[model samples]
Target: MVRVLLVDDEELVRVALTAILDSAAGIEAVACDGPEAVGLARSTAPDVVLLDVNMPGADGFSVLRELRALPEPPAVAMLTLLGSDEYLHAALRFGACGYLLKDTEPHLLIDCVRILAGGGVVYVPPQSRAVMGTHVNVPLPAPAAPELRGRVTGREYEVLALLAAGLSNTEMAERLGVGMTTVKTHIGALKKKLGAPSRVALAAVAHREGLLDTASADRP
Candidate 1:
């Protein structure tokens, strides 16, 4: 059986996650808030831990550090609403094998949990690939993607599409014949407008939103 731990301050979230994971075949799920997490994980020895980043007393990063230090540590992942680079970096630095957005669909969540349990890593917004670069083990996925109609500026959308296509910031600047600063500005705006956390996520969002499909989109 695959043992999974769901950690979140929100009662509803914990319950919901537990139910979802429990419903999956060959998986057993247990949940607790941040303060109770390390203890629960130690006692239960879950195969995978889905930790929440922002919590009252003991935050996710600290708990994650403790979990990784266990004599027989389980695969840990940060599951949070905020998708910022700072949190993503901290999770990786602290040894989280996965960094997932809370808004993730149910099936994808299960797949990520399974992957992490079986000694694998999952990076949410493929853009993290460029930043982290083979630091962890994983496979690339081709998502179905979404539609983006006037949600971002034309330049920003172009940057995002190029980002999805696996172009680095330096590469993108050269491709667009713009200064690095200009490219950075467009990326920042894209993240703010689209609520993406990191450049990797920006790229992931680019593919998720299918920005390339509408390269001719209207700009403001």
Candidate 2:
């Protein structure tokens, strides 16, 4: 079984995550309420740590740093309410294996745990290409060949904008009043045109092209 240490302040989140992880075929979830996480993880020697970003004390980043400093650091995946590049980059830089959003689909969340166990870096939904720094150097994605631009439609642009803004398919569907399938179709087409490997890369390409302005404007 893949032993997991779940660290979050909220009782409900911890319970829900434990339920999800434990119910899965080959995983066990050990819950920790707050700053007690590092000690528990050290004692248990879990395979992975599903850490929350905003804790009462010694927030996730600090916990992660301490974990990495350990002689045998377990894989860590952050569970965060905020999806900003600053948090994502910090987690990754501090040796986190993956970053996941709080409102993730149950199945997806389980899959992410498995992926992290298998030594993969799982990017969260609505992948943002922005990095942490004052220097903003957005590069064009190589996949969007010259011919593809001639075929991009208006809706495709909208999808790219939303992707750049880190909105998930479900979120985008609600905002745009469309079905998830419809949103996915646009995303696939955008990927084909832009040659982006994933939505996050696509968002980076969109930002390079200045398509995120519309979506950013929509935000308060």
Candidate 3:
């Protein structure tokens, strides 16, 4: 079972989210206000944390930073009513594993938690990409070998391409016609070769190095 910690200043919001999470199979959720978030996170050692962006005192960013500083930090997913690029980018910079709109469907919310718990990243509704402008169409330059600082195999290159397209591990597995473990292995290899700290950073490096452009041209 995946243990989840819910952090929100609003009592009603915590109650609603906790109920939703508890009812789902294979999940157990506990709630705390922003002030208590870090302490409870250390004590409970949850697998994932669903954090509200707007809180009365410390706010989400501060809480997120503190949680990430723990010896064994839980994966965090920012839950917010706002879709502002500022908050999204801040959360990513602070080491959040996911960003989700509060109005997301309950089932999808559960799925996002499960994904994060399984060592995957999630940023949903596609519009969330606006924060990084990751999907904006731009004129492509002539194809060249992606300047990967470290050697990466051809199969690793394929995985990186799908990853830059924002596909999750499960999606990558289906696309590659491989097992989930194989997809994860490729992602791990890519992370080491690219020296990326997170999936978001890995995608950013791919864009910066023109890997995305190369991948797009190669797609038939």
Q: TM-score winner among the candidates? A: 3
Residue-pair clashes per prediction, in order, are 3, 2, 0
- Tens digit of per-residue lDDT, candidate 2, span 1-220: 8899999999999998999999999999999966898899889998789999988876789998888767667778889888987887666456576788989999999988886664445667465334422212435445443455456676777777765655656667887899988997898788777766444456556666555664455455
Off by over 4 Å in 3: 69-72, 124-127, 134-150, 173-186, 213-220
TM-score of each: 0.60, 0.59, 0.76
Candidate lDDT (C-alpha), each:
0.74, 0.73, 0.80
Over 4 Å off in model 2, which ranges?
A: 129-220
RMSD of 1: 15.1
**lDDT for each residue of candidate 3 in 36-147, tens digit (9 for 90 to 100):** 9999998899999999998888689989988888887888989989878778778777768898898999998999998888667888746676765642232223223344
**Which has the higher TM-score value, candidate number 1 or candidate number 3?**
3
* Order of the predicted models by lDDT, top scorer first: 3, 1, 2
Model 1, residue 88: what's the lDDT? Answer: 72
Q: Candidate 2: deviation at residue 121, Å?
A: 0.8
Whose lDDT is greatest here?
Answer: 3
Clashing pairs in 1: 83-197, 127-200, 128-200
